[model samples]
Target: MKELLYNLLHGSSTIVTPMDALQNMVIALILGVVVCITYRITYSGVAYSSKFNTALMMLSLITTMVMNILGTSLALSLGMVGALSIVRFRTAIKDPRDTTYIFWAISIGMGAGSSNYYIVIIGTLFIAATSIAFSFSFKKDNKYLVIVRGTNECIEAVRAALFSIYRPCKLRAETVTDDYTEIVYQIKLNNKDQLIDYENIKNIEGVSFVNMVARDGETLG
Candidate 1:
């Protein structure tokens, strides 16, 4: 078992064998598959971009290939960097998490390609577990900004009504007008089932109208 493990880690350096190249390629392919699967399972965004996901998988495989070639020669490494630097990516990333995933995929590929298989496996597993933990935690603390617009006479009534239904709400901002008033609330709630309850608020006496919007922890304009 020790001999087998040593052979896998050190690799055969005497001759450039087809079997060795094939083994490296297979390892890279497996790493790519793992990355792709993890990304798919952990994704939480509103829309899932298959293109981006596919790009991540390909990046893992390609980066590993590049690292393998570069590992063989310093000259090739420099040339590879030059070639990659000239390539421009114009796509705009909406979520900050997407950028992190890109880096993770690249790291996995480079680690495996350089024959640091242990690092690649352990690092990927660690990152994946951390990401899943964070994702679930964020879901629990879901917050939203609520904007309420009504008449001056109804301002207090509005505040009282909102507080009665949704506890732990904070008044973020307020605007006074000749006939109407606009107030914003930073509300942290346990569930979204109470969202439609805002309609009852609009029915309050002296209230002209009530507008409630859901924001992901951002101030409502």
Candidate 2:
């Protein structure tokens, strides 16, 4: 059993030539860009992160390099597994679309590293086309959490202003204190341009503040 394990670990591995390594890396880079661009094009989130987008691109390159190195040796592959097992990723993925992009980047890297050009090319094109189609077909409404703070006397006025400017406004929360009232509304807009009336809402009399925060579509209600 010991001898078999040793032999398995030290087995004859595929040799990677310099030209092959360069080709794999270049392909991975190109695929990474495609993945990044696809994510950017289909993304409909308030928190559009450039850092995460750049990470997606780099992740493909790094995965390709790791796979290339691992392909050349069985013992090193085992070691890499052990090393990676010790690392912990604490970052949270706020959107499911971002998770899809992450997986796509990794898959592209693996395919490129294994020199599966046809599968990578065809699969990428199909996935990108599908994503674009869905993005256009079922458009999403832009959502915002509108917070209004004002004196008790302005409660009616605040409601009037919100209802006049934004329709279908759902009240998320309402807190009435002895001196003031705080109202939170979840408003949906067909386009982001509809939020341009913020200054008008802020200028209302007795209104302490009017703040709008871009938010996801999900709600507890």
Candidate 3:
């Protein structure tokens, strides 16, 4: 048992044994799962890509493997660095936060690969906790999009309905033809209990159609 623990901690100089390699791989995988769960819960909208999430997990595993392969050889580590430089990534990350998560996952995987289990587990916990903490603000600013179609006279009558809510509303888009007028509004509410005055708007003089869509707080329609 002492010998097994010693191998895991100090890392092997010659070849990776079953116990050392398995322990690192398992740690990398568990941390990868933690990263994915944190991302799913904290990301504000449905715009997130599943493929990107998958990549994050794979990146962790790959990094762990790379560290295991390098072992204790400085020359091998330097060679691996040069080899990594030749690889090019074509994918573009739309969200900066995604990039941060990817970087974090890679770092965690590297630590695990190097058999630094304490750093891998503790660092993953810290970053995941920080991300989840930041997500609370987005939850408070719930966003909704409302599209109202009506005649000019109908729209004029409903102007008061927009201002009646205890929230901020911005006029996002307006389209008018000879027969019908359509207006789209972007609303931000401080609380979930504060509902929009949808019925009041629909009850206005010339309203032909009223539609409301609830979206992930970060997305705008």
Candidate 4:
């Protein structure tokens, strides 16, 4: 058992040559670019971050380099795992889809590092196609958060105006005081034509103002 442990820690079965290392790095770079482009194309987040997108590609390259250096050495591989475990990411991932992209980038890097080009190429192409196709196939409905601030008197009228335009106008939040009232409603529309006629609610007697904002918090009007 001691002899086996010694061999496991000290020995490496696969020796990475300079040419092979170069090939792996090149493959990782190419696959990383593919993943980055795919992410940009299918991104549905509130903001498109060029820096984060660039980091995705860099992650692939770094992962591949790590794998190549570790090469068949059990001890170094274990140490690498320990080192990685200490790292903490503070950035909040708002969109769940971003996690999938991150995993995809890491997978590509690992595959390239191990010279599994067949699986890497085929899997990447399939995933990219699936992402693109799914993005196009199921269109996202236009969703808006309608914020109405006004006197308590026209609250019902404001609701009526919302329900008249949006079929399923959902009341998300409401703040009511002695004379002031603020109501937030979530509405989904198929197109701009279906958008609420703000004048209808604003024209009400007690309504102070009506504001429409997209799901991403961008004010529409």
Judging by lDDT against the true structure, name the best candidate.
4
Instruction: Give lDDT tens digits, candidate 2, residues 59-165.
Output: 99998899899885789887999999999999998787788899999998889888989999899989999998899999565677888899999889889877887
Q: Which whole-number lDDT from 0 to 100 does residue 160 have in model 4?
A: 84
lDDT for model 1 comes to 0.74
Sort all candidates by TM-score, best to worst.
Answer: 4, 2, 1, 3
Report the lDDT tens digits of candidate 4 across residue range 42-155.
887567999989999999999899889988888888899999899998999888888888899899889999899999999999999999999989977688798999988889
- Alpha-carbon lDDT, every model: 0.74, 0.84, 0.79, 0.87
* TM-scores for the candidates: 0.73, 0.83, 0.72, 0.85
In model 2, where do residues sit more than 4 Å from their true spots?
1-7, 190-198, 217-221
Candidate 2 TM-score versus the reference: 0.83
Which tens-of-lDDT digit does each residue in 25-64 have in candidate 1?
6776777677677778778655788888889878888887
Cα-based lDDT at residue 212, candidate 4:
84
Off by over 4 Å in 3: 1-14, 48-51, 78-83, 137-139, 143-145, 165-167, 170-173, 190-196, 199-221
Candidate 1 residue pairs that clash:
none
> Total clashing residue pairs per candidate?
0, 0, 0, 0
